[model samples]
Target: MILTVTLNAALDITYRVDALRPQTTHRVAGVAERPGGKGVNVARVLHALGEPVLATGLAGGATGARIRRLLAGGGVREAFVPIGGESRRTLVVAAGDDEPTGFWEPGPRVTADEWDAFLGRYRELLADAGVAVLSGSLPPGVPRDAYAVLVGLAADAGVATILDADGDPAYLGVRAGPDVVKPNARELSALHGIILGRSVTVGTVDGAVDAAAAIRALGARSVVASLGPDGLLAAAGERVYRAVPAEHVAGNPTGAGDAAVAGLARGARTGQPWPERLRDAVALSAAAVAAPVAGELSLEEYERQRAAVTVTELR
Candidate 1:
């Protein structure tokens, strides 16, 4: 079984309108809600792919309850610990032709007791999991080293771990020696103090490849950089593979990285070669962008993209 941990899970709310204007009241044309946060999103894709997955995290309040209900209705296994603080809700608005704008909550504070509860639960969950993923941010009151500690626990349980985090949590977690670390171009650039929304091209990709190497040297067993529409670059052991889609996809790219992480986890679980693993990751990411919402991927596009993905060994 695969285990996923969402330390800062949320109720992801999306609103679609003809146009969004400031100081104006607009009726939303459509509204969709789902269980969100990196790990939760990854678990959704994993479950959709017929993988046995258990998603665990911290949740509370009515919103948290709604999240649990949504997960249950979706048939995703969840074992989130209840918290004293209410969980967060993230809002994304898409106005016709324009880019989506997102409003995120800082999330409710989690006390020490709540953190301990999750750690104990995580330890118990590891026994049944062959792969464990720790993703997303640290909620208030939870230490930045939370992922690091979880990675260590998974190591002792003989479970391969994947870490998807940002900032200090990511920096610290990378040092704990997870089997894989998935970070996008921006996240990778942040480590080198060179983050700005740059174009995803061959030249820029080479820079990301270099950054990935630095991450691997920090104790990460492998590094996979999600390069948006350019596809993915993965390095494990002494092998590197770059997987690129045949064409660029445009749509909601919110959960693309999580989809890729799911694919990576699936490939690792089966011990597929690096090239096949990257091919799967890139195809799933493309399908995610074609979907109207996050978490769901278009199987039709996925099939095509899977065959369309071109894998090049760079090592």
Candidate 2:
């Protein structure tokens, strides 16, 4: 089974309005809530694809209890370490044709004892898992090197690990040498001013290529950069493959990246070749875009993209 870690899980709230206008009164047309955060999103997509995946994180308070209840009802196994503070909530407003606007509340502070308790729990979960996905942000009071430390622990346990994060945590975690690290194009652009162990700025795929390679140099076995709408550029072993979609498949894009991560995790677990891995990643990503709801993938679109996606090895 694949294990997913979300240190800062949230209650995701989405509101649909007829038209979202700035500084104007509006009535909500619909409301939806779900357990969220990068790893939770990935777990949901993996479950939908019939993968044996378990999700764990820090949760507490009424909101956290609600998140767990939703996950349980949805059939996603969860093993969260209870915390003292209330879990945060993410609010999204969808109006007209405009892209959804989101407001995320800062998660509650984690105490030293709580963090220590989690370390033991995480290691226990890693034993039964083949791949561990460490994604999303660090909660308040947690160290910036939290992901890095967890990656090291996973490594020590002989488990393959995938890290999907950004900023300083991303840099530190990459330094810990996970099996794979995934960063979106924009995340690569800044990279916390460190690429190839040197300070630099990058935003484009071309720039990320070098950064991706640098991350590999830092100890990660491979790196995948998610290029929005374009597809994926994956560097594995000594080869790089560019997986491009035939056309844009657009819908709710919130969980597309998470879906892509799930593909990579599945590929890693099965020891699939780089090309096939890229195919799965791009296909799942496109399927997510074609999905009607958040955290869901269109199986039909997934199958079609599997056949239509073009994966070319880049020299």
Provide the global lDDT of candidate 2 against the true structure: 0.89
- lDDT by residue for model 1 over 1-315, one digit each (tens)? 999999889999989999999999999999999999899999999999999999999999998899989999999999999998899999999888798889998898999999999999999999999999888989999998898999999999999998888878888888888999998877777644422234333347667777788788887999998889888988888888889999989887889999999999998788888898899999999999999767688778888889989999888
10 residues in a row with least lDDT, candidate 2:
190-199
TM-scores for all predictions: 0.94, 0.95
**Model 1, poorest ten-residue lDDT window?**
194-203
Candidate 2: the clashing residue pairs are: 189-202
Total backbone clashes of candidate 2, pairs 3 or more residues apart or in separate chains? 1
For all predictions, the C-alpha RMSD in Å is 2.9, 1.7
TM-score of candidate 1 to 2 decimals: 0.94
Which lDDT tens digits does candidate 2 get at residues 1-315? 999999999999999998877898988989999999999999998898899999998998998899899999999999999999999999999877789899999998999999999998999998899999999999998889998999999999999999999888988898899999888877766563565455576756677678788778877888898898889988888888899888988788788899999999998888888898889999999999888878877778899989999998886
- Looking at candidate 2, what is the lDDT of residue 253? 75
